[model samples]
Target chain A: MAKGFVAITAERCKGCGFCVEFCPTRVLALSSAFNSKGYHPPHIVSAEKCSGCDLCGMYCPDFAIFGGRYAR
Target chain B: MNEATLEIPYEIPEGARNPVEPFLRMDRMPHIWCAGCGIGTTVNCFTRALLDSKANLDKVAIVSGIGCTGRVAGYARLDSFHTTHGRAIPFATGLKLANPELQVVVYSGDGDLFAIGGNHFIHAARRNMDLKVICVNNMIYAMTGGQTAPTTPATAITATSPYGVSEPTFNLVALAEAAGASYVARWTTYHVKQLARSMEEVLKKKGFCFIEVISPCPTLYQRRNKMGDGLDAMKDYKAKSKVRNGAPTGECTLSKTGEIVVGKFVDRERPDYLELLKAQMIESLGDRYVEPEEACCSEC
Candidate 1:
């Protein structure tokens, strides 16, 4: 079973762009689509290939994300 | 005849407590202060004031606006808020009103307080709220690459005032006293003991208290203006400053031809704003505020 990863709270994210630029594995990306507030939303580019590095969570300003193993 | 065995007792200087052991954050240590800058001396005076006041460490909150002096809040060992430029007074006012028991202090630079936040400063003083504000005036805006601040002397060389400041500076003590602050004082870093005493007095004052500490920013202000190094700047402060406790505002101007008056300029007692508000609160609430319940839970 693949190890699960953290979740990011979409609403609280300040859109500082730290997580998208920091993750070494290049798993996160800013989508062209916008959130309710009209800012760019962060999205997982490779959910199935997550390395569980936790870099995104560390760099996030809003404490929006948490990671764990995938659930059934 | 026993000169060889003059057993000396190991001693520390008066008010000396572990110089290397930082009561402020070391990560923020060696702040943007110029080498031997006097702001650090002011920071030391503040820490000493805290120790002298024996104020509840946990109940103390320091708020700072942007500039060189604003960095002090980040380093102090207490609940500190590093807020935006010139907004520390308003932020501290809110904090004091909210918690009444907290020792709220707003430490800011000349530019932050007298320039951008001048209106707030005057209004806060007029309200006479229970808060202490320490405005560190280096006579120039040491941050933002040296500009002519509200406290900058006329004819000072600065990035924005390449020709000369062409503007007279504000006398902060008079400004506070006229605005109705209960306590007002001005002291330079060379007057460390006096500054500490002023801080102590302000800490205990019931209404708004303002202490303007004249500090030296040798790096930006001095280097660009040819004011010499930090030590030289300090020597200048010591030699040029004239001691006058209650000198009129006109005599304290920071000019080559004017006397640099330094001392406690004003002190008075008045009904504090928070106390008045609390009295009004109790009168209106009529025991609702006093409603006591143990192990309380609320269902939202």
Candidate 2:
């Protein structure tokens, strides 16, 4: 099985939670720490479970988060 | 202090660059769209379509009118024109005529395209001009506040229509077909793959190609109408939409709470405006007519 990773731009996230809500594998969660924009960006809660589908990226209006796969 | 007690920090991997970044103006990052607005999703699909189509980016031009979706032209890292309200179609028509090699696309919202620009829309399709038009229908006028628009579904409450809109809405697919657009399709932001595919098809096709993207406006339209939020609208689209390719345009009418018919309705070959113009000129003017190439730089 291929592993995946997720990354988010802190300031770009508006805390709409679209990425977190739309993640198919439940790999992401909103961080308690707030960005400069006073919004809680998504954080990788389960990196090993990410499939890198990038649907989160597709649905994110802010262009804040992206997902990618890694070679074993 | 214990020697092994130091906490080794977990190194964060480098963030993956957004695939659509190349097509977007990064300096204009953090687009002004409200959180949960579907315009951004449409933009994502559009940029992906452009990349998938492998179009000559330099030869592509985007034109838009005054509205939220009209802002799309400004964010695209291409030759773009933000024209006056209801003038994007004619402006793009002039651009296509001046240089037939250029692929001109007009991106605008419902009110901008279907209201004030409604006449231009029909005539452009009537002439069969080679223009790709993407009309994002959020149902209401979102930019100037949630007001009743020509595409607004009947009985929807808007700022201007507090008691519910009593007028019937224009069926865009029917109108486009009736006016003679060579290609016509409809999709929602939820149907990103289909929308992108349609965009690619229209890019490669000639004549007036129109795509109506049903997007959500969470800020005004959704909030006023109590339509949940952007995600809810996507869920609604997923539940209500029925994809039936080649369905008659007359059967694609949208209702307040009925099934949404979506798909590519029309695709046919037609002699576009420029081709007809050249043929007419050749027959009428005979030897007196100078080809554009021959007329080029004649004064110099």
- Which numbered prediction scores highest in TM-score against the true structure? 2
Which portions of model 2 show Cα errors greater than 4 Å?
A31-33, B1-16, B293-300
For DockQ, the strongest prediction is 2
B214-272 in candidate 1: lDDT tens per residue? 77777778877787765566567768888788776545667733556898777887888
Write model 2 residue lDDT over B66-95, tens digit each, in one string: 999999999999999999999999999989
**For model 1 chain B, where is the 10-residue window of minimal lDDT?**
B3-12
Compute each candidate's TM-score over C-alphas: 0.71, 0.91
Report the Cα lDDT for residue A30, model 2.
75
Each model's C-alpha lDDT?
0.72, 0.86
Candidate 2 backbone collisions, by pair: none
Q: For model 1, state the Cα shift of residue B117 in Å.
A: 0.6
Error of 2 at B204 (Å): 1.0
TM-score, candidate 2, first chain: 0.90
RMSD of candidates 1 onward, in order: 19.1, 4.2
lDDT of 1 by residue, A1-72 (tens): 235454555544444454566555666676555555454546676665565555454334234443444444
